[model samples]
Target: MNGASLATGQRSLGDPSVTFPLWPPQLRGCPETSTAEIAYPVEVDYAYEDVDTALFAQAPGPDLARWAPLLPPLHAPTLGEGGTPLLELDGLPGVYLKDESRNPTWSHKDRLNRVTVSAAVGAGAPGVVVASSGNHGASAAAYAARAGLPAIVLASAEAPPAVQSFVRAYGAKVLTMPAEDRWPLMRRIKVLTMPAEDRWPLMRRIVDRFGYHPVSNLTVTHTGHPFGAEGYKTIAYELFAQLGRVPAAVFTPTGYAEMLYGVWKGFAELRRLGVAETAPPMYACEPAVGAPHARALATGTPAAIVELGPTGAYGIACTVGGHRGVRAVRDSGGEAVPVTDDELRAAQELLARQGLWQELSGAAGLAGYRRLGREFDGPVVCVGTSSGFKDLETGRERVRLLEDVDVDVSLDDLLRATDA
Candidate 1:
């Protein structure tokens, strides 16, 4: 593999005093700090150089590893995860959709898993572990399989049947359990586990003993995976190349807002390198049930945990907000908009009418844009995060069979029956 110009170390978001090496992926909570709830987001430094602006016009390949200069060393195999299409709606002028459902796993999580599972391979771990509601597990399992590693998926019993089946089909050992029980067992097993609350300390222990790499949050508040978000940066690169410039705004369906942060970072990098004059504003759209990012922005905190109520947009219903998300919103002068399930459903139907079948949660960005009811100075992009097939409602329709036509029916009779 061609080596990346990865810098020596990383700095913490909560405290600059807490720094660590880029290798052996660091935790989200700072050990030197007293408050574990304060998310310590680590940033990987790279030796970025100014490249020719004309290079942006080149088409990006399906594999994100082709952009290795901007990413960490990757060891996992690719399944054509990136290079999703940017499409425009017929009726919605100055609005484009970044169709993430075109990915291998039919979700944006494929980008994250591509990099995170590679961390497991880089660490020489025997297997990978993840605690997910649905899509994350399915993507992680597929990537782990591609890396020739065993995958253990600890998913919520409430996860959709289709998502569960996807994980199992990827040859990952799946355990359906309550959300609270997933982390403890994963840490004990010393596998590379996903982010969760009440498990950071134990994860630190497992990392120390078994050298298991973690690619998700480790703090009470979400800080996000350092390298995993790098995969999402490709979306911005593709958009910039496709649009010939940055759009005025980008609306994303937000959970922990990893993709939101990563997209913003990519645009910022382009501006820094003189590829673009400015970065677009980022809008984070979340289910109104929780919306921790909205709460944090309103309360003016780096991170916040909010009590969640039930909502149909489960994919974006995160209880905690990440500091990276807050930074992205603030730096870009953007807003976090809370959307209702009703609005998301309407957006889903609208997209479906346009021949784009997206998950309800994946349509949150469109819902937010409609809720805003304002026009942008330039083109706006809404990221459709996943396929409609991943939603639980996908296969629930009942098909009614018409009475069978007689084999001996004449052509006139068939025509008469059709006319009737």
Candidate 2:
């Protein structure tokens, strides 16, 4: 079992004393979430004292199973996730880019789905369901298919066509609805009015009726699968080994802040095991269009729901924030960074020049770092979450133009035509 028994129990982030056994798989959110304004996420606790420091020694590779004991019971089949590269860029001094687009589904969500799907398998659940605009849904679909189970993706109709096709290609049931309606339907709270009745049924009563385990959030706020965030801890472990020490700062793209919290937890675990003395401060990067985490942090609230604005970077443009993010920031003495679409596009372009084609939202770490506009004491790390191919622009029908730009014209005219 690779010492999997070291995982002691699960506890609520709001009230750590509210705990439960990890065995039978706590796939559901905090059942004690009583208030509408304050839905808390639960987290996994481990016997870190029992863990041997020698196990921290790792080589470069794309397999998270090696850290199986540090992670949740990974009953789901592997799709070659984790162990992404930590690269240095020219413009940002002492900052390394931890590119996660290398995963099976070309997104960091692969790490999360690996554990979430396994929870489904461990629990003997029928299948899995999730609500995502892009990467999360695709990763869930791929993992579910690998586990020989069906998946239902409650995606936004506004989601890029390529992402829509990517999810369906995995044989998942794709139900595209208005972005706002997806969450309420998952909670089975209330359905919203839409243009068509067809999209309505796609989001309703998935868990209660179909008996499918929800791999995404169903709480009033964004308390996703407890095991999912644990998957992201692998990133921190990989970073420590790659850099030869813990960094002074780490920037992460944040929608629900699961990844932000997970990264912090991994480093915290290292401190607990005495492998490292300190955990780096995590910076949660969210689109200014709707930075709920940043808003909550400013107001001294655990989490908040913000009035959202439109932006091209949809992946990290979340409305509801989670308490885990708050805990991570507060515990680590970190702060939230809100990024604008202009900054996201600029960051994407910058990384692309560095031969890293991160998606608009994927470049959020750089955007946040740039927004901060300063250098750190020690090495800094900025996480790149997804590929540029996952961008909405990649789905548009402009690729056909590349077949022939009519190079018959003069060199000057050709350069002008191609916008070179």
Candidate 2 has which clashing residue pairs, if any?
none
The local distance difference test score of model 2 is 0.84
Please provide, for model 1 over 283-397, each residue's C-alpha lDDT reduced to its tens digit, 9 standing for 90 to 100. 9999999999999999998888999998988788888888889989999999999999999999999999999999999999999999888789999999999999888677887
Best by lDDT: 2
lDDT of 2 by residue, 1-420 (tens): 245636778888777778888965554467775376777888888877678777788675776787887888888889999889899988677988999999999999999999899989988889898887699999999999999999988776577878878888999877654546565554553223332223324434777787888888876677888888999998989999999999999999999988999999999999988899999999999999889988888999889998889888888877789888988988998889999999999999999998999999999999999999877999999999999888888856442234466657788866666542
Query: Could you give me the TM-score of model 1 versus the true structure?
Result: 0.88
Q: Compute the lDDT of residue 278 as modeled in candidate 1.
A: 97
Each model's Cα RMSD: 4.5, 4.1
Kindly give the stretch of ten consecutive residues in candidate 1 with the minimal lDDT sum.
190-199
Q: What lDDT does the true structure give each of the candidates?
A: 0.80, 0.84
Q: Candidate 1, 19: how far from true, in Å?
A: 3.5
